[model samples]
Target: MMLGLKTLLLFGLGGQELLLIALIVLLLFGGAKIPELMRGMGKGVKSFKEGMKEVDEVKKDIENEVKKDEE
Candidate 1:
């Protein structure tokens, strides 16, 4: 079972390859800075979601106005 799982994970990337990439990231940023990086990414994602909600609301308003005009 473990072997099958490992093979699935390594379909395109070997275990060594993944480990090397992770090691590079850790070395470049250090473990202490990872949380701060993740926090900033979270804030960015939240802001994007809020912006999308505003756009959707505006689209609904426009559609309602168009329907009223047709009536």
Candidate 2:
């Protein structure tokens, strides 16, 4: 099963595809920027999570305020 998968992957990329991707990344970001790029991605995900949590908090607060106002 695994051998079949590896064969498919090898056929897909072969040597030339791998070389092309490597050259593109090297030209675009050079060596030093890869980690920075990944770090920024991590921070973006974190900020998204925090923003979602804040939204959830505000929603709950609004619900409570409405309940209190009704009472």
Backbone clash count for every predicted candidate, in the order shown: 0, 0
lDDT of 1 by residue, 1-71 (tens): 47645885868777787788779989999999989987998899789989999999999999999999999
Point out where model 2 deviates above 4 Å: 1-26
Error at 46, model 2, angstroms: 0.6
TM-score of 2: 0.58
Tens digit of lDDT per residue, candidate 2, span 2-57?
Answer: 66458757778666776787789889998899789879988997899899999999
Off by over 4 Å in 1: 1-20
Query: Which window of ten consecutive residues has the lowest lDDT sum in model 1?
Result: 1-10
Best by lDDT: 1
Clashing pairs in 1: none
